[model samples]
Target: MSAAQRLHQYLRDARRRRSVDLALTLLPWLAPVALLIARWQGATPAWIALLVGLCLIGAIAWRHGSRLDTPWLIRRLNALRTDMDDSADLLFAREEGLRGLQRLQQAWLRQRIETAPTTELRPAWSRRRALVSLLLAALALAAVALWPAAPTSAALDRLSPSPQIAAAPGQPRLVQQALRIDSPAYTALPPRNEPSLEGRVAEGARLRWTLRFQPQPDAVALVFHDGQRLALSRAGEDWSAQRVMTKSLLYRIEATAAPQAQTRRLYRIDVTPDRAPQLRVLEPDRGLSLMTPGQKAWPLAFEASDDYGLAGNARLRITLAQGSGENITFREQFVSVRGSGGARLKRYQHRLDLAALGFAVGDDLIVQLAVDDNRAPKPQSALSPSLILRWPADLGSEATGIEGMVKTTLPAYFRSQRQIIIDAEALIAQRRKLDGEHFLKRSDEIGVDQRLLRLRYGQFLGEEAEGEPKLPTSDSEQTPDDAHPAEAGASAKTEAHDDHDDHGHAPDAKPAVFGEEGSVLEQYGHTHDHAEAATLLDPQTRKLLKSALDEMWQSELHLRQGHPQQALPYAYKALAFIKQVQQASRIYLARVGPELPPIDETRRLSGEREGLARRGDELRAATASDPTLTALWRELEPGAGGTASASIDYAALERWLREHDERVPDPLAFAAALAALRDQPECASCRAQLRGLLWPLLNRPAASVRPRDGGDASDRRYFDALQQARP
Candidate 1:
């Protein structure tokens, strides 16, 4: 062969060697991955494992083989052969394309390569790495082979079968059983069969049970835990029954021959419910958005998710609220927007054109997204929270005073006291239509609005904003007549002041000055002893305002307690008092200092300290403990120690649980525990379960350090003698 042919053969051999080395280096790592996939699938077929393995090998070969081309082999050959002068590429090139100098160099290189060894051209292989990887792969395979397999339907059936009862030798025995589940169409799941009688299925799925018994009984039926029975019709040699799964329950098979008998073992069926679609708005971060000038379109994005799948299209409810106040007009329109994403989660986006929606200044464009899940019969739907795009109205500036003071009015969106009263009345009217929980929630929301308004008004009286008003004191709890005695006294004083104004002068009254009236100290001195003297209103108006604040406090209290009906009376009274204060005239007068009363020297240090006693420390009683729960706890305590009761009054304990069920963390679980304990009185675990459930319900004692016990008589006498000796 020529020098070029020998070089070509050598390059071909090197490429094969490189491919083999790569395959060997990668096989161990890829084998573990394929094995892990097969194990995760749980008893995957051999054909599937083979196909996955072939695909992985093919991918590795195609990716690594592409790098082992002729140019790469030539580069390796040049790097290994020092005498070639880096002209290995010329040997592969066509002789006709080679120039004079290249031709001369190729001839020289070919002569040198003809005698060069081909073994030196092969790529280096790491024998130690390959050996270690092979060892690890072998160990991994052994571990996987020995690992316990996941439990299948057949295994479950073997573990939980009908109880073995010793009956007559001719009694029928269950030969074969099969449960076929047909899931709902919306779930897009194919029908499947399970050999186990106890299995979890999707809600609303149809379950068909088929059982063949040797020497068939006259009749067969399924008895459920809820006291319901389903009879199975005889078909050929098998008994079959079908029902739609709705809830989780336990059931047992019953067969009747000459003597009827029910299986002692109960089969459990767990149902997974279909959840409603949840819609979340993603574009507008806040519920309320202000429209800026020159804005043309409002873009909205929403995401809806469901356990099964979301519908193809979602409804965008758009409501245009125009104008302001009671005269406002609302125009509602719904737009269908197609969603794009996986079946479980879908995203819908819509860009609303401002011009098409007829959005204008002083108008609000409210939009909410409504989505439905792919549930059959009637799909459960959800509505996103309403997002308002407000185009605020322009309020012109008012330059009224010489200093150009700009006056601003309250926002029109601010809810007023009258609106609160109206909402309370409307809620009362709709109480019969709403459920108890929803009604209470609505009442509480209105109460929150009322509290915010009360806090705003309190700002005028220099009161700090608080979450809840202080509980009414004994003085505040009195009737209006008794609570507002200052009103009566102020009215009487006003009448006397009016009488003075009517007459030119009184016999005992001094003449009034223009700036300094009533007393000479009032014009120059400042006194804060009386709250009414520093206000801009007269005593009578201040009293009315104070009464209004107290009424508001009462209204807020009842409203927050979900008693809108009881709060209406206080609300109306507060409104009436507020109206009176609004209509009262502002009487601006000079600051007045009170006249000093003459000191009584006889009463000042006479040492006649009668009717006075030192203040004593008052003690509050701790919360009372429930005796029924205590007795139940004592009876349920584990182990044979500590005065544990022999028997418990379960009826009394049940009554107490019913009364305080709201306070229990999980009342249903607690009831289940009680029932379990009652049915299995001798069970130790049952007793422990009941005790655990009862422990949380019992009243927690105050976390105070236990007081040290009083010493014996002799120790007390010694301490007393020591005290006497010290003196």
Candidate 2:
């Protein structure tokens, strides 16, 4: 390439880079702005803004930005490119009349340029500046893309002015409205202004409106769609009205002046109702918890929110399972939780004690949070998802051999108690060989062990230790079951066998099923073979063992009373209850959690909001105003009565039908054919065929054509003469 061509090409590339930089900067700003517009639901504004931005970018990119003239190129080449040795000046001189010094210099410059490489003539690129601009632009674009989004519709409308009002044109006659809505103090809402005619406002808001009509009408009234009208009291040229906005509605302005040019324009109002409280669990991160042996407490945390605010207090709904396996009963209690945070958001937390809930080693507790909001008509509530806190069977421990299998597979918790019963039996058996004082002391120790074991069993039925008749208390309030702790089948400890033998009954005759569907005996009933019993003990054998444990308990009690004879029978009974509870079966109780009110998702943000009344107004305006045309149109509509009238102007009707509908034939052409047939009655067959074609046309109703208001005098005279000549 020549030096001038090289210089121009480099400058053109530089111009393109400038355009690219401009577009990059614009893109970062434009994309986010377009997103915001879309979020606001402004489709027209988004499209218009997008089109304008694209045009501006295009002009800069392909036209204005790329305008690199030869003169400007030469100037840039001389200033930036080092290889051009004053060749620009020599090149410029070639275009002008070269006098003495210029001609000599031009010749020298040409010879020097010829010796240099074409690469030397090319303008140097500012790579560092371009790279920096691209990086900064990319960062800005990413930042905009990653920004947190705002809420939709209502929130967007609140921040930005209505595009319709902003884009409305200045007209000779137009209705404008300015609304101020004062929310009730109880709602804790502030007053708001809307320049546009329509938007949502708080229910029970006091709405004040100022209506201005250009070319000023004399009187105006707000006509509601529900057949109610509120007359605006005039003050000078403006009209005003005030009313408490209790419900949403569509309304229009009906204006009247001295000359009576009736004018109408419509608007809409929406009322936003207060929303219910929402509650969700925020901590522990899981719904179900299988607690370890040593876990003392559970961490409880929740989040609650309401559109208005929260009042009173939040509560933890606690459901405790009060037995082992299938016979478990669920008991629920509401415990108040300390809530922190104002109106919008609140946090609730409590450290729940496992022991206080009367949970045994095999029992479970189900819990959830409940929240209430201050809304009325009726206050609303929300319940969090249920969470389980269980003292599960020791499935986590590793053990070996048949003993290990028994420890892992059986109800392992009560195995120690059975050992205590055996020890007591052995001690009672050797009582005759020891001294009286020593025997009494050891028997007393065994009695104490027996009471402790009974209390441990009692806790599974939500009971306290022996001698402590009341249930335990924790941070939360507890409501005990109606049945006393002593009555829970473990009551055999309180009454001796002597009383049972004489009365034929113990206190509280009802048997404790121990979380089984029936008696532990019933679960293992029947089956006599040792091999069968080894596989699994039958219910009858289990019943016999339970009877033996009851006897062992009485025997231990008698020994403690310094009478070994009475203790032997009870010691046998103590052996029975232990053997039954240890059988290996899958022990499962249906976990019951907090009972929550069913959520009505359909009621969310439910309120009255209508589309803009202007769209309906446009549709009404486009409807035909002339009654004749309207009636004709309706008659021609699908499913309309198809009756035809003889008086109808078939020619005019056909013309109207042909103009409005492509399906109808030309009435004027049919008229000319029939008229020609009338004159040529000599051809009878042709005339008959024309009459058959025109018979349906003759039956249609004649068009009631209104005379033209203004017409040419000659045309009017000719039409008058034709009317006069008609018979």
lDDT of all the models against the reference? 0.73, 0.59
Give one digit per residue, the lDDT tens place, for model 1 in 81-110: 788778788878888998999999988887
How many Å off is the CA of 232 in candidate 1? 3.0
Best by TM-score: 1
* Candidate 2 positional error at 402, Å: 24
Candidate 2 yields a Cα-based lDDT of: 0.59
Runs of candidate 1 exceeding 4 Å displacement: 25-45, 48-63, 93-100, 117-119, 126-160, 165-201, 210-215, 223-229, 233-238, 247-254, 258-272, 279-286, 292-360, 374-378, 396-727
TM-score of 2: 0.31
- Give per-residue CA lDDT, model 2, range 188-255, as digits (tens): 76666677767788777888777766666666788764457999887765578888887666666676
- Candidate 2 segments whose C-alpha is farther than 4 A from its true place: 1-177, 212-220, 226-228, 231-240, 243-248, 256-263, 324-330, 376-378, 393-727
C-alpha positional error of residue 607 in candidate 2 after TM-score superposition, expressed in Å: 69
What TM-score against the true fold does each predicted structure earn?
A: 0.47, 0.31
